[model samples]
Target: MASRSPRTTIFLLLLAVSLPFVCGCTDYGGQGVEQWSSDIPGGEAGDAVFNTPVQSAFTGEDESGTGFALQRIQPVMDGAAATEPRMFPVKFETREYEIDIDVNRSVYEGARTVDKALPAEYWYDEYRMLGYYSSFIGDPAIVTFLDDVLSPLERIRRSDNLNDEEFLELMVTFVQQIPYDSGAPVYPRYPVEVIYDGKGDCDEKSLLLLGMLSRAGYDAALLLFPEMHHATAGIRISTNGNPPFRTFTTSKNEKYFYIETTVPTYIGLYSENYEDAEAFVVPLGNGEKRFTRVNYVCHITESYQKIADRLVFMEATMAEWKQEIEDMKSDLQYGTYDTQDAWDDDYASYTALVGDYNSYVEKYRKYAEIYVYIRDRPYDIAGVYRRIENSNVMDITI
Candidate 1:
């Protein structure tokens, strides 16, 4: 499909008006979610770890961190709506892939240097862990990292037949088997700790789950919130029925399910209180090329709309409006649009243009088509401007 156009004046206004509440402080950056199955190489193919009736080593501790419980996970709520499929695939040869490889070696190896595994200090700043993993997984540079590194590991685990809930339980069980290090302390623990000492912390546990999930061929993402970083994998949202979930397949005959690897919580457990936070996903299919935001919510309040309309009223007057577009065009042509600098520039220009209304609409009407051409998208603002420009009726106010 052709690229979507950038929002015209009206669209920009609408977007601003429709802005969702900014997520509370959280570092949400990581590779898209991946699911692994027994077909890959190491893990169980289609069995749930919890359902196997394995005895728990830790039980009965609550706030003081002394006990463990095998509480049955509650079923996930049927939320607002089924999510759309991933919009873009990780382009095999893009710059995203190269970045991820470097990130993998850096963080993966960096953790090994620390003497202790699963440090307490690192728990607070989950972003550091997220950055390291995101660098590897989400970066388009390491397109096949999920398949190459994680698949073989899952093959050995033989978790090929497990469903999402089962797989999550299995991961928790696997972690529970290894005790957290209480003697020594390290800032960041090594990935080797999972097998080396059979222990890991939040990031380590999450990564282990990520690796296994990737091998299973499931699409998932890492979620970073102010206080915690977690994982939320996708389950087919459209199907209807009790225990309705999408299945995972390894070979032609074998299949597994989605798992929530971060928490000890089982799969099939999500609700408004326990929700799916915003995440970035790497699509497995051949589709778009950008890292589309996932699980995002936008709410348009009347107050926001009023502000947006006023902004559009002013943006059209500045001669620099077209100049800004030209600059963006040049940057895009040379591939600088992805740079932080470019985003900053766009933010500045957009912010400045929307400061005044009458002048903004006047200029926008004259060049609405050209703006649409450059942006490759239309907007409510553009519609308004197009009408005003074509009709030459300048008596509208918001």
Candidate 2:
């Protein structure tokens, strides 16, 4: 849900092809390295393996540094629902080669207008930490927290034999399960603190999950929804994936699949408020931070097909219901309906069918409206899945 940047990062295309779906991870689990290739045109991305920790970055001792001095404060698990401070690896893969990153001991929290006087460090989209050599500021504390979060799940993930595509879903589910607390003190909490605190608001949770994705080697970025006071992560995903959502192109034009971290969801799914909200894409120094576009269609073909199927079924059902009602009315009007008991039974059935028909009509109307919306909206297909997934769940009504 992150947004609100002085700059506009929206790339408008009324309809673009769906991003490629994540493929199976094969045997890349355990210690084997997985190499990735460039799916987007401009980037020369190839081979990235998260098999080993970026050990060297956290190794060196810093006597003095120019960057912001940050100490890993032991976070207090004040609430009973805290995550108990455990680490779980983010499981994903790219078909590229290995790339090295140097984690700077002193990380710079880039130049953003900071009202030093403000009591709560309400992080805004303007405060995108400098993402250079210090791509992810490495602190022993943050590293350990990440490990704690990721380690416990290694066995379970391995046991499930999850592929990269499947792994992304699992990873997102893990982040969503974290309890949310809006009362995080003003300052931005390190991934460690967020984990220890157990509850995190949108921005805090987004960073913690982003750190995990960085450690696990999936390409991810920051999405600031400033106007909405929300933050979300955008992960690198193939344009052809089944995640019925759209992506945002970085200033460099590299597309990152939008994901909602504060709430548990598959990548590219988000709130209705941001359905057409302009997302500010903050780069994480992952090569090709600039989004790339290939003159594509955005909405899922399968989604459209499903809608068509439903439309056909609804139309057929509506016709049958109408016919039944018409026949029942004709019999009564012609006085050929026989007994009062028969009349009562027929009336009741007619009423029930009327209700059903009305429901179908409303549903079909929504489907058609969504179809038109998807056809014309720029870079937003998330509603297709959101509506489809949550559509039929009913509430009790007399």
Against the correct fold, how does model 1 do in TM-score? Answer: 0.29
Q: Give one digit per residue, the lDDT tens place, for model 2 in 240-309.
A: 4433456677777667776655543334555555667666676552432211221222334445546555
**Candidate 1 local lDDT, 1-398, one digit each (tens):** 12233334423332232222221112233222121111112223222121111111221123454322222112223442221111111111111111111123332333344332223233234333333343322322122323333332343345345344333334333432344443323232333333334455444445454543443434333333332333333322212222332333333322222333332322332333224433333222211111111111001122223334544544432334445555555554565466788777766765554455346555445444333221221112223334434543333343
lDDT of each: 0.32, 0.44
Residue 209 Cα positional deviation in candidate 1, in Å, after optimal superposition: 0.7
- Indicate the residue-level lDDT of 366 in model 2: 68
- Give the number of the best model, judged by lDDT: 2
The residue-level lDDT of candidate 2 at 12 comes to 19
**Candidate 2 local distance difference test against the native:** 0.44
